[model samples]
Target: MQVVIEKRGASLKVKDGQLIIKHGDQVQALAFNTIDSIVLSKATVLTAEVVAQAVEHQIDLLFVARGGKPFARLWSPYFGSIATIRRHQLLFSRSPEAVAWMKNVLTRKMENQQALLYALAMPNHATDKIIESAVLKIEEDKQRLQQIEGAKLADLSPRLRAVEGQATRRYFQAVNIHLPEMYRFGQRSRRPALDMTNAMLNYAYGMLYGRMESALIKAGLDPMIGFMHREEYNRPVLTYDCIELFRTWADWVVFDLCRQQVIFREFFEVEAGGYWLAHPAKRILIQHLTDFFEDQIEWEGLTRSRYTHMSLFAQRLAALLKEYKTDKNKK
Candidate 1:
């Protein structure tokens, strides 16, 4: 079984170690052990006992704020996962090998970004031109990064920031061109996505982020610690960083759905420069996004669902961190 998400207007209760979900007039119960993550789309009435039980079972509870934004998450520790702490320490140790590993990680991220751009550019020559420009910007950022001294981490940071902004702009431009005018925003801004399509996409993005956060926690990584994204006061910077690697996947899913006409433009509205998805549209988009993630996708010599691939990637990262710590201890 995979992750389980419960929407609003639904109630969940723990009875004899089983989770009973009540939706409308129907009720379904499942063993709590079978559950991985629970998403609360809106207000939920969960008991303190149930919360405690979920924590004991290491089940992640994710809460979505207004406009379907994931603003808070709660997770329990795995019994024997302490390597993430060690990895954090290694990252701060400032050793040559640590720096090398960080560089490798960043290189992989760049490669993934390139792959996504290639996919987006496949549809048209004009789009290809835009993607090529973005690619050049990425390359320039990489070159600048290589020339930066270790003492100038702050200087290298801005290059990465510029590259990310360029990449996102390229992506959004392609996306906006394909989408209805209602979904287009001249600049990236939070809240009130400009139309139904944007609202649905934003909600889907939130869901994906919550799932990635749970995966990170399960792998024992500190969701707040990160390299590409700075450690903000309370933001889960690591989750934000890792999400950058996979957000293109979500974008592609939404884009394809829009192209296929599987979703309707009438399902969304624009108000106050923000987009809103009707409840029905939200339901359909969520299900479509969920299925897309669960569908099998080939990666790294294995055929695994995107969801599984994400989990495995987090685990691999954790293992790499452990190896780094072991080498440090030996030295």
Candidate 2:
């Protein structure tokens, strides 16, 4: 599983080949094999031995700032799969197969959104109309997505984004209906979230992004080389592409927290810039999100944890890309 070191002044060390974490009076030791990743979110001390052992055992070290945004990641340079996978990945970005993959990913995302709305809809309620309308809009966009013909992502990017953008607006419009008035938002905001809901959602999405990037890297895929997303300097565009499939997962977790009223204004710190989650709010979001990801769900006709589903998809995509005989590499 994942070990989150979020407590201020926490420190990690290696003792007898086991991972030792100490914060205040609490101390815990974890076996190296049992730990998948370590997320450092607050002031934490670690020795060189700890980093070496983590890399030796293939454990990832992800660092995040106060707003839950991942700023850096550490892993062994020798961990990526054979260079053949990445060779094909670059060619795959412009191929017809890439177009198909993009369409499939987006449609699946829209399908998940509709499923969420359907699950939330109930009988004899004014909100049912709102939810139903949102589902219809998303479905219409999904149909439009399927009808679009393109040889490559360039041919499809703009129209695809338009449909996805419209559908997302409708989806969030319905989602905001469920939020308490104090937490409801007019639009999605980032950088500095203007409302409590936006702040929580942004933080949760950031956490998801870090996990998804780690998964892609472990599968021997290059997170910077994207199929549908535009390439930019020093950006993990592939993570952005793959994250579409799982955004709803983060949305579900945050929505549940909001509905439960477990989050309050006091949990947030309002700044001249906007709003940020206090340390307590961050802890609550992390706990709930970690638990939600570990919960088993029906995926690909089998029961698997949501975290496993992402890793499996990354591995499968890497395998599939390796099999493709790109035009440049063809005999």
Candidate 3:
């Protein structure tokens, strides 16, 4: 379980081996061992004692944007995994192997998008013209990706991104149609979303981002070093790179909510940033995603929960890097 403090003026600190949270006239205490991470939402004030406890208890502290987009994080300086993996990660960033890995990542991403659109278009009651066209666009983009041949990061990244951008536009256009008229945001917008749909999508991605960061940390890999995306100051580049592979899943959850009519226009409020979910509605989206993550899915000839598959995928990624490093050293 994670501890989340979203109330403004809430003060958090370690008190006698428990997390002491005081907000307004209320107070709560949560045991450190039972906590996985601490998420402080907008305007929550944390004290130094809380940081020290987090480090000692191997907990991560995630600070999110007001509407729940991932903004920053804090964790222990010492990693649970070996230093060699990080060394290999930096070396792997520019290797030919990085390009090959990206090939698998992008292929899976596009295929998943196409699959989602096709699945939605199949039923007579569910037949969607926009989704069918989006599937065709994604397929074309996938073909373009296959035509690109350079093994060098400098040559491949831009070519791959251009194809992805086209497919992404098509996908969102299709997704936008499924939302109700009040919720439809038309195109994807961020860093202060332009509409209700964009705001919901941003919040969903933020939740997924936190999960990815935790998975990478647990797998003993550095989330900062990455291939494809350039290193930016304080950005979790690898997290962004890895997330592309799973973005379809996140998109599906948000879109599915709209299809099921679980998220209506009434659940939102218009604010300075355009739109945000009412607190209760936000919690419902998260709870639904929690159920979705635990559902069974067929992957690699085995059925597994989405959450477990994600963890296994991260471990496999680390192993692939190790293999590449070992091969490079021998040559």
Candidate 4:
């Protein structure tokens, strides 16, 4: 289970194989063995001992802002699998295969989006027409991806981005049509999140990004060196690159929550210029996403938890990079 510390000004430390959390008049101790990931959000004071213990226990420590976006992550520097994969990842970032990698990830994203929208449209003809139109648009993007085989990296990059952008727009439009007027949104908004549904998506994706970082690090890939995303100041580039494959999954989660009436209009606090989840509402959503990440999904021939799916995907990415380097050198 994910251990989330959301109390304002709370202090978290480690002692004698236990995680100790203190706030005002309350104190709690958690056994390290029971924890998989620790999330520290906004004004939470995390001690250095906790960092060492987390590394020792192979636990992921993530720092998220008040807006729920993960800005940084900490994990054991020691390699769990192949150490050379990190070195190979850097080389892959400079090759044409980088474009290839991004294209594959984006293709999966669009496919997932299409599947999700189409499935939602089923059993309810109200959304069928709009959603199917977007699904057809995604098919065109997939065909465009195939045409980029011999294109220059500079040329292919924008084309891929355009396809992804257009597909996302169409998808959002299709899904919004089913929502009631008060629950509808214009488009995807970030950071401050001008609308409620976008808020849910950004928050869920933020939490998922932290998990992806943990998985990438466990697979011996440096999160800073990535193929599709730019290595901006302190950005986790590899996490961003890998997240493209899972964005639709997050979107589906939000859709499910709405369908189940888990997140409703009354839950959002209207303040200033936009809508935001208050502390209590956020805690509820956090629990929801935690369960979502652990939920089982069919991968290939077998069923596995979503977390395991991401871990295996990262492990395979490492192996693919290693093999790509070997074949290139042989030529």
Candidate 5:
């Protein structure tokens, strides 16, 4: 994988054939071909041209925003995958079978979330109970959703929002349990994460979000469309919805590694009311996450690696959407 490691806080630009990285008065050049993901930890200078080049090459660009939140993301237009578009359109068309299939998929997703949360809250039974309660709430929501008949879209909206909020609350609570004491949150905090662990979580989550965005696009699902999440400005709603299923698993892996000291604290620092991972730690986290993706996972009586499973899931979602479109065309 092409890796662009940004070590200093500086401005970044792409001119001619080189990536111009500037920190204060110093500037360094890296060839475009040598970089896969452009990781900005504490880098200061970045230009539109740099982003454009990275997008053109389908390079995964990651930003470590304040709070050590690492965001692995790419612009929507450049990274658009044809397969994802087709699948998304297929799924969006409302149909009986389509809705049923979506329900089943979402149910499976919740099951996975429950399992991951249980694992993450090890030695703490409270987390498992919370997940169990969320499961019940999901059931209630599913029933309410199915019962909607000529129901105003507005009314249905609030119900779905309630269910989503409950589920999210449970998930976030579990996430906080794994965080460092300094970064443990009482409520939602944005931008700069307060401690090293939270910073890593933010950055790691960004990377995962980008990957999920790619997957949704490949599945032909509109990233901005969602079932459990409301449409919001500048947010890929569907990506957030689907990510709920897998985020816990990813978080578990990273937290475990951190707790084991596999990723040392020396690779990070506390600054400006937030934490930042050093260049070396960022590299290690990315490498380890890559490994985590390659590691095998068990689902639905089959054992397959996460990378393989993700690809397969995208294909399956695409196929389901195609079926929906076909039936619609017949009608």
Candidate 6:
């Protein structure tokens, strides 16, 4: 289980070998073994003991800003075997196989989007037509990806992104028709979202970023190295690349909430910058995502929670990288 500390002035510490949380007049204690991770926003405070205990218990400590973007993380250095995996990761990042891996990732992402569009299709002919067209376009994009020829990811990255972007545009346009006008947007926006849907999407994506990063680290992969996403200073680009495969999960959650029309005016604050999810709205989104991720689903003849699926995928990727041998004679 994951524990979140978002209350203003909330404090976390260790007592009698148990995790203790105190906020205002309420206090709670939990066993260290029961906790998998701890998320704390800037408003919360933690003692050194808590950090030490978390590291000792191999629990991840994620710190986020008010906007729900994770800025820092703490985890046990002993979490995963490192040297061989990290070394293999660097070579794998530049290999032709990495290009194929990215194609598979993008293909799965578009497939999920098409599946969502189909699931959301209604009896209305016009809407069904839009959804059908979008699915066909996405299918075409997937075919283009399969046919892409590249010696390295750099050779294919631009074309891959262009095709993916076009397909994504069609998918979102289809989704827009199903949304209430207040929640719909002309396009997907980030940094500061222009509409309610984009705002919620940005926040949900931020959470997924953190989760993906954690999974990568625990699986002994270097999150900084990537295949499709360009390398940059201090960026976890591999997380960005892997995240594509699961972004539809967040999309489905946010879309469901908007369709329910349970959103209140106070749930979001609009500033000159953009829409910001308020504390209440953040809590609601977190709860929904946590429940959804923890629920079991069948895939590839095996049943597991969505969260476990991500973890296993990371482990499998790391294992593949470890077995990868660089061809020194290519030059």
lDDT of 4 by residue, 43-147 (tens): 898878889888888888888886677777777766456757777777777777778778888888889888888767766575677787889988897888767
lDDT of each: 0.67, 0.90, 0.78, 0.79, 0.61, 0.87
TM-score of each: 0.81, 0.96, 0.86, 0.90, 0.64, 0.96
* Model 2 lDDT per residue over 92-183, tens place: 88888898899999999999999888777768889999998889888899999889897888668888888888899999999898777887
After aligning candidate 6 to the native by TM-score, how far in Å is the CA of 13 from where it should be? 1.2
Per-residue lDDT, model 2, residue 238, is: 93
lDDT of each residue in 206-247, candidate 5, tens digit only? 766766666666455676665445446667766666665576
TM-score of 3: 0.86
lDDT of 2 at 99: 88
User: For candidate 5, which ten residues in a row score worst on lDDT?
Assistant: 148-157
Choose 1 or 4, whichever is better by lDDT.
4
Provide C-alpha RMSD values for all models, in order: 3.5, 1.4, 2.9, 2.5, 5.9, 1.8
lDDT for 328 in candidate 6 is: 78
Spell out the clash pairs found in candidate 2: none
Compare candidates 4 and 5 on lDDT and give the better one.
4
